[model samples]
Target: MSYLEFLGQYGDRILSGTLVTVLLTVLSSVLAIAIALVTGLMRLSPNAVLRGIATVYIEIFRGTSLLVQLYWIFYVLPLFGVTLEKFTAGFVAVGMNLGAYGAELVRGAILSVPRGQWEAALALNMTPARRMIRVILPQAVLIMLPGWGNLLIELLKGTALVALIAVADLMFQVKQINGTTFLSAETFGTALIIYYVIARFMITPFMRWLERAMQRKLGRA
Candidate 1:
């Protein structure tokens, strides 16, 4: 069959797969952002205990392979009587893994903020939480925007791994189509184009808009 005909036949399946991929990406990205912010702040906590906990989490997730983490969470966890649905396991694994990396980005960005900002907040009698929220994080977020954008793109590509957990993401659907039709070139090529389109047209644009918005908020635009 021609490419158009093939697409016509399987378009619904492709759409379903695309929707699943988008869902996984959005959910995982949200989780990763939250974890990064919390763990990154913990890394800078005055309490040694908090810093130690963050360090251990970062090391464990960053040092290990994500595939192993996925297997452990999805397959091996049942041994300990903890079971997560495939989609849950997939996003959790991906989010935690990426969050470890993003935490470092957050830490670095926060550190990059001028020391004067912290002192100025202190002079104003701002509490630690208030200082960070009002004075520090606003500046740090601009520094971290590019890094976060890159991480988000990586997260998008990484969604392919979810297919291994039977989450029915784009890659899973493409693989299934290829297996049945043996149309490696068409199936895989379509998937490649779709991913590129999503990244280029969706993620990239959103990131750019976010950067612009932040810049305007900070009066840099």
Candidate 2:
């Protein structure tokens, strides 16, 4: 079949897969950011225990391959009597892997906030929590935007790996359509175009908007 015919027949399936990919990206990114914030703050905490726990989490995820982590969560965990649905396992693994990288970004951003700001907050008699919430994080978020934007793009790309776990994401559907139609070039090329469209038109623009909004909020735009 011609590429146009293939698309006419399989377009809905491809679009469905794209929606699943988008859902995975959205869910995993949110989880990753939450994990990054908590663990990054813990890594900087005065308490030795919190620091140690965060250190272990960051090192373990960063040290290992993401595919290995995903397989462990999906396949290996079942042997230990812990079973997760494929979607959940995939999202958790991707979130955890990216969260490790994001933790360092968060830490660096927080540290980039000038010492004078911390001192000013302290001088104002603000509690540590209040200092972070009211003074420190706002400044740090602006600094972190560029790094976070990159990570978000990485996370979107990484969603392709979930197809291996039978998640029926865009990549998975591409494979299915290619196998049945024997139109590998058309199927895979279209998948590539879709991914590029998502990253270029959707994710990048949104992140840029967010950066501008944050800058405006900070009176720095």
Candidate 3:
């Protein structure tokens, strides 16, 4: 079949899959950001216990393959009576794996803030929490925006792996269509274009706008 004919026949299915992909990416990104911030802060804590816990989490996730993590969450977890739906499993795995990496970015950005800033906060008798909330985080966020943007894109691409566990994401639907119709070129090509458009047009632009907004807030623009 021609590409047009293929799209016409399977457009609805592809659209549904695209929506699922977007939803999964959004959920995973939010979870990742939260995890990154918590773990990153823990890594900076003076308490050895907090630092140890953060270090273990970061190493375990970063050292392992994401695919294995997904499979373990979906397939192996049930063995221990800790079952999760396929979608939830995929979301958690992707969030956690990327969160580990993003944590390092968060830590580095926070550390990059000048020593004088911390000293100034101390001089003002600002509590640690207040210092981070009012002074350190604002500067660190600007520095971290570029790294977070890159991680967001990577996380978007990583959502494709959810297909292996039956999440019905873009890649899953593409595989299904290709299997049934045996039109590899048309179906897979269309899937590629759709993914490229979503990442290039949608995610990239939003991230750039966010960076600009943050810069303006910090008077750095």
Residue pairs in clash, model 1: none
How does each model score on TM-score? 0.98, 0.98, 0.98
Per-residue lDDT tens digits of candidate 1, residues 1-221?
99999999988898899999999999999999999999999999999999999999999999998888998999999899999999999999999989999999999999999999999999999999999999899999999998988899899988899899889999999999999999999999999999999999999899999999999999999
Assess candidate 2 and give its lDDT. 0.95
Residue 12 error for model 2, in Å?
0.3
- The reply for model 1, stretches above 4 Å from the true place, is none
lDDT of candidate 2 over 1-221, digit per residue (tens): 77787788999999999999999999999999999999999999999999999999999999999999999999999999999999999999999999999999999999999999999999999999999999999999999998998999899988899999999999999999888878888999999999999999999899899999999999999
C-alpha local distance difference test of each model:
0.94, 0.95, 0.94
Candidate 3 residue-wise lDDT, 101-191, digit = tens:
9999999999999999999999999999999999999999989988988898899889999999999999999999999989998888988
Q: Least accurate stretch of 10 residues (summed lDDT) in model 3? A: 1-10
136 Cα displacement, candidate 1 (Å): 0.5
